[model samples]
Target: MATDTTTFKHVSYLWDEAKAAELAGDEVALLIYRSNLLGADLRLTNYGGGNTSCKATAKDPLTGEDTEVMWVKGSGGDLGTLKRSGLAALYVDKLRSLKNVYRGLEHEDEMVELFNHCIYDLNSKAPSIDTPLHGFLPFKHIDHLHPDAAIAIAAAKDGKKITEELFGGTIGWVPWQKPGFELGLMLKQCLDENPGIRGIMLGSHGLFTWGDTAYESYLNTLEVIEKCAEYIEQNLGKKGPVFGGEKIQSLPKEERLSKAASLAPVLRGFCSSNVKMIGHFTDDDRVLQYINSNDLERLAPLGTSCPDHFLRTKISPLVLNLGTDENLDDVAAVKEKIAPLFADYRKMYEEYYSTCKHPNSPAIRDANPVIIIYPGVGMFAFAKDKQTARVAAEFYTNAINVMRGAEAISEYTSLPRQEAFNIEYWLLEEAKLQRMPKPKPLSGRIALITGSGGGIGKAIAKKFAAEGACVIINDINQERIEATTEEFQEAFGKDSTAAVTLNVTDAPSIEAALANTALAFGGVDIIVNNAGISISKSITEHSIEEWDRLYDILVKGQFMVSKEAVKIMRKQDIGGDIINIVSKNSIVAGPNNAGYGSAKAAQAHLSRLLSAELGGDKIRVNTVNPDAVISDSNIWAGGWAEGRAKAYGITVAELPAYYAKRTLMNEIILPDDIANACFVFVSGLLNKSTGNILNVDGGVAQAFVR
Candidate 1:
């Protein structure tokens, strides 16, 4: 469908050189920048709508030589802040070869094969359905936008003529075509016809442009859309009649009217216009005359501004004319009329499909409209969910505006129906549906672990990496950090983990660590605050330095990491899980742990407070209080267990068994146990269980029996 030119002019691009540098190289930075440009343009038309891609050369595994690869934006990724991992890389040659095979394969089966052939870059996520289009383009950089200004014009009568006049011969125009295979073919044809054209404008669809470089492609897109917006603004005002003055259509019941009223806010939210009910009879003659016009049929094929938007809005809105003497307030009557109309629409879709399909190439798709825009009444953009609905409404609103303006010139035109169908049902477009190994339950998921070089921290880091998460292992000891990273690389492939030597007490170190983590893993999805220092001196004898060190590592470190992790998590829309490793001293104080006990106690309270405050964003913060666990690092070298045993006058040999016997299992607990507990805390099973402490110390500390 046509996009709104006005909306295109207001589109903004998001770019950050620092973020680009963090991504590792200029090539990735360029990709992110171009993706953001496309994202901004699509957002102007439909929130979270559209996809973009880049084709580059990568070393092939089989030949060990450079081969073409398509780097496409992943599904469900927000383009505004997309990172390198947000893109999925697939072999471009493989996808291009599929175009030559015209066996009329089932879309779903072919999709599976395409996905099977798809290869994920070490960092990127799964590619979007539009990956094939990127492969189809000859240029290195490609941009696809569902621009409101363009869709608006494409959706109106004489849309093609308007596009030709406004954009002229420099821009190739393709008729309305479904977005996958058909659109690809139409685009190919346009390229063949106008080899020198800068871009192709899809009538009743969107726009496609490419360049040799990311910047060039992005700038070209901006320039073209800006021109389109200027043309629309100069020719036609982007305003519609206010719905407030429309006569209210009388329904059989008040409830029916109420339902319509309820929908008004939603419509107004998108259209930014007041809603009023125009009774079928107040201006019966005018309403009927308008409905009876042949233009109604002509507008039917305008379809959706883009095909993916179909998931949000239905195909089209029903044309309704209220009858005189009908009950003006009956909700049931309204439902009755609407329900039957959907059935009729379904039947009509089937008939259309049957008429259009060729014996050798015919295939059927679900009979659902992307959106329905009522002529007199405000439009109802329906999607499978609210998110989709919002996206559809945005695209529809812009498309309508463009259509209205284009009608000023000539009858808007679109690609043939069959062409649109091919694009909508192209095998390449369905590739994303293929099943792959479920991301290691944590793939694309990030975890920041403190004290990750030793004991529980190391265990947790390795465990998370084994489970498919990219781990950011943090510790104060440089040696431990490097050693732990080495151990993790040995256990889980080297590419799965990163190590950062960060002193928890240092703010700059913490910030740098977080920045590095974001660059390495895109963003953190989980934080395990396991770093802490313990002192055994009595409160009166303990030095201020010792106390401060304890608090800094246990309390301040957790705070700093949590704060930064939460910021990234919130922006990424995946609420993170923060598990603080507190001691049983926080729940049960003892005689000689003034410094350690106080710090642990503060950490526990901090966890509780963060849980309460961040719960609104769905972030789960909790404490894991373990009584005591014997580890090589913690027992032999002035570790907590060794110090406590010395204070109790116990032998090192007896200390391990003594603590084990104190627990119900009488089994010595390893660091892996604590790591496993942390894993459980971050998993979905504990998604709703936060703000409380989980005691994983066997039976040393009983719940509610301190």
Candidate 2:
């Protein structure tokens, strides 16, 4: 459906000659520009999947003589966001000289270590394994991209024949080979056999294009991809409904999304058995069409053809065979059936690993599937972080497009199981995994802090996000939400936090907010009931309306929020934490504070009640009681400071000193102090404790728990 009506579809020519001229003389700059343009379109390549390079003559720092250097994207760098610093510069002559040491296929991996010796700049980033692929090519500029359209032709059963027919030998074909020195040599051999070919289609892999200039290579790559997409589109137009027509009708939009949200937590739980995982859900038309089609059963089990796709989505996806006839709303029933489905999938994966693993293969990683396809609903992807989960889903979508194009022209052919295993368990890949930095304490956890627009709520949100938790900052004030969201985005990445408007006292509002949170970052793992209101008046001065407002926000608000969050936590089947931001007044009685004190008392008791009731489910409910947090507190800003100052027979400015002098430690309390106490409960330090109250009032003895 995305095909171009006339000249192009699936991709576009986005080159800007005006921009290109700005960096005309700098080869690395031009390479970055070209790579960015190609990466801008997912149809061209998935994130961090492809590599680009250019050969340029530069001054050798050591010899002070002009030498040809190859600048290529460094290991683990993404093209779209690449900077000059992300490139690895290696001496072209030194790379070429390695041919004498190359001992053939068996010693290919050893060459990776040798690449370090060819480094033209000592400060350059580590070279990618694909360095040899670019080094062995004779062209000044080259691009190896995994475009779905190009890969479709490469993944077909008769791919080699199709390549000859599509480009009439202008584009050559090479049989399937794992990337290394051996594959690089195979490419050189192919070029030797066909001298005039514009590019080479690496079987069951991707396409490689080259040109004497950066602009030329950029154009040639786009042109070849466009041609392949057009040919596939024409063939698809003549074919029947994709994947042998839809076998099941998709659910209505609202129902479908609700079902996805309901199931995401359960799936996340299943996937996190080995380690916690964040989740992503998508119901894009392509995914829906594939999952609802007749061929899903056959094609999904065959697994992804491309290595990039295989790496992200694992060897195969687990397809859930739920039908429209089932009760979509009965999440509990669906939950019961899904466990065995996941069990069966893990069993199959173990069998696959056992069948194909070599003696040197790395120990099996988690057997849980990274991707799960639910018929009539959509696809779900889980990973150790939010971005990876989302990107995994995107990569799988690319796989779906490849399948559609390959099936339209020729029967889709997946990589052989043994080959897929080799890549999945490659020692180089294991080393890459081992090199990753240790995950943060709160990595993969999602936290929702109510009233996070300012004050104590904001502090908790910042702390959680800094600890690597994806935070949902909830408040009724849209303006404050936007401001705080922007601030967090600048500090942590945009994906690290989401903002939502919520009124915890209102049931529908609470439901909508939680649903949105689930949609934003899968589901809730922690809830900080920090939303509150205060009316510091005596029993006689406090009107019924004022009393109700205080109770509504302080007592009922917390109960409603915790009630909704627990549902998600229970479904997740993972233990969770709920921290209530109660006040010291909850225990120590004081004058002219009837409404505020009673509401705090109710909230504190509610926390204890929930802790007792929810202990069976491994959901901890704890309380943080603070006496006075005058700084950055909206409660103090809104006349409560004056009321408290009057009660203590002091000025508003003296309120801080008054509250601090009364404490045993004689220390003033701050919002961050309260946040720290909350952290102590949810930070896994107190994972086994529940129904506990951590007072953060600078040691207020009167407010201490008995």
Candidate 3:
């Protein structure tokens, strides 16, 4: 029978009898189905925070005898995305036998390597640290989750007392212990001592529930969380004004976001001192409620209670209390104070490491805080990439929920300082970090390419994204922006790129685009001034309006975009690249192209000027000159092809062959060829050289830089 959805109030009941029935009898499949359901709701477990397992009888290959085997989630796998291949299958007897060789708590880490010997299936995924916790339980089905409500109770000052009162001896309690063989033994001992307990609350950790079948375990996990959520909700309603009432009024929506945009670049720069970092900003109601509250100062440094939470958010966030109450109007003034505070934070982090370091501690990592809180604004999370930064922000948000619940019932408690450090710099964790795939050259870089709807701009965006840079696809048409954004989102991840509609000649539009880029991925590190329009006509035939339009797009557009982008790059204090896609007409001086050719010449000179001016700030500006790029070009589609063909005494369709023949190398230029030239400048190959022009005109001697 299907579980009645109406019984559950705090959490969603997504289990469908018909759907689950399809996966029945296949125990591993049922385990995956149950895990997916639990993980589907963040209320149950945040991303990659929990694990589930089932013990089933499988055929032993060597003896062809049926043996009990444990299939548990592998290290680093998310429960929601769990698959058969994601589970590490091990022989139950082999895992149980390791208890004989266990050398006590001091040498627990060695158990990790021993786990490999217990594999029931060849080529199985690596088992998680919590593998023994499930393997020794002796339950047919088990669930371990980090549900916020349960964690709130777990992290509460009176967590044990509350558990005894709430469940009345049905749920047992275990003191805070870092995950390892020791904790697993502690869990087993608790189950043995409390013979009738339905579950266990892992103090300062999470919850553990079990049952004789998959359905029972899933139902028990949900019921426990739902009951806890109900209790938290009741207590919260009784308590007036969470976090001792809001200390600072939240800025209005538009004003709040505008402030976030203004401050993000500066903060991003400070955080990237060690390595390039991406930033994520959230003004979610929960974040504002906490940061704007009086207790923010106290709780911000206390840090997160859950291991998963601190692993992502770091031990503590750096809270900035800019002098003014709520008015952050003087952004420059506020920015000035941020640097010294950040320096203090770095010093404090280093001190913590030095004090906590053991003989075998891993070297200190980036001393900068992963999370930064501005009371009236919101929270900003920084990491090595967009998705990681976003996830860290989410983990901090979960910590906020836990804190709210714990405070409503009892005082909220963070993990002890030594414990937090132990987990943060664990040798096993250091090994995992070392095992990660090497980062791509442009891994942490963010690029904004204008006129990327199609043509050279689109090609450049693709190449940069492929090389691991997050891209912002900008175009004048909304449809093109949507299409390109969707395509990039599919190819890369949703976090890998964003889209903006822009008209570069308009200053306000340019500012809005830059702001959007800041909100999307901290700030822009590479600017490709590719937005352009071509008008091919004789000087006498060209209307003044045509000439102005050409200049507005090709020349002034590049100037405006560069002008705005440089401001952000300067605030970031990180060197950046600006690549302008000019045309060979700038120097070759082709006929019937007066307006286009003059604008191209102006654009080329602008690159040189900016290269000279911004060199002090380490900003490199370069230009790429491509001639007769007729294939997949918006310029050719808009009557430029016809005009150019007329000037060259050929039909529109003959332009490609005719233009190619005119080049010294007889090579026809494609949009990708121009994109390659842009990469050459931004790929760090020409780091020292600037104020130069590279001609991509199939070796056109006349267009060569003199």
Q: lDDT of each structure?
A: 0.63, 0.89, 0.90
Estimate, for each residue in 1-706, the C-alpha lDDT of model 1 and write its tens digit: 1333335444564445466556544555687776765665553445556667777777887889998887877765767667787787778777777776634434533443465465736466765555665667688888777775666566556666766777777788887655554456568878888888888887666788888877677767776777766666665423432211233443333333333333322222222111111111111233322233445445544554455443343344444443433342453454455556556766776776776665644356546443443443333443322233445556555544444445543444444556555555444543432443454566545688888888777788878888777787777778888887888877875557777878777888876776666434344678889887677766687889888888888899889888866765554444679999987788776777888888888999999999999998789998887766677435245555656776667976788777788788777777888888888887667789889787877776443333
lDDT of 1: 0.63
Off by over 4 Å in 1: 1-9, 13-24, 41-48, 57-68, 74-83, 92-129, 152-168, 174-196, 237-302, 320-377, 414-706
- Stretch of 10 with least lDDT, candidate 1: 273-282
* Tens digits of per-residue lDDT for model 2, 1-706: 2223245555767888899999989888999999998889899999988999999899988779999999999999788888889999999889878889999887788888999999988888899888988998889999999999999999999999999988888999999998888888889989999998899999989999999999889878888998899889899836688899989889999988877777778788888899888888899999999999999999998998889888999989998867756674566887788889998999999999999988888999999998999898889898998889889999999999999999999989999999999889988888899999999889989999999998999999999998889999879999999999999999998778888899988999998888878877788899999999877777887899988988999899998999999988988888899999998999999989999998999999999999999999999999988888888988875578878878888998788888889888999988899888887887878899999888888888888788
**Candidate 3 lDDT (Cα, 0 to 1):** 0.90
Whichever of 1 and 2 has more lDDT, that candidate is: 2
The best candidate in terms of lDDT? 3
Off by over 4 Å in 3: 1-4, 237-240, 323-332
Off by over 4 Å in 2: 1-8, 328-332
Ten contiguous residues minimizing lDDT sum, candidate 3: 322-331
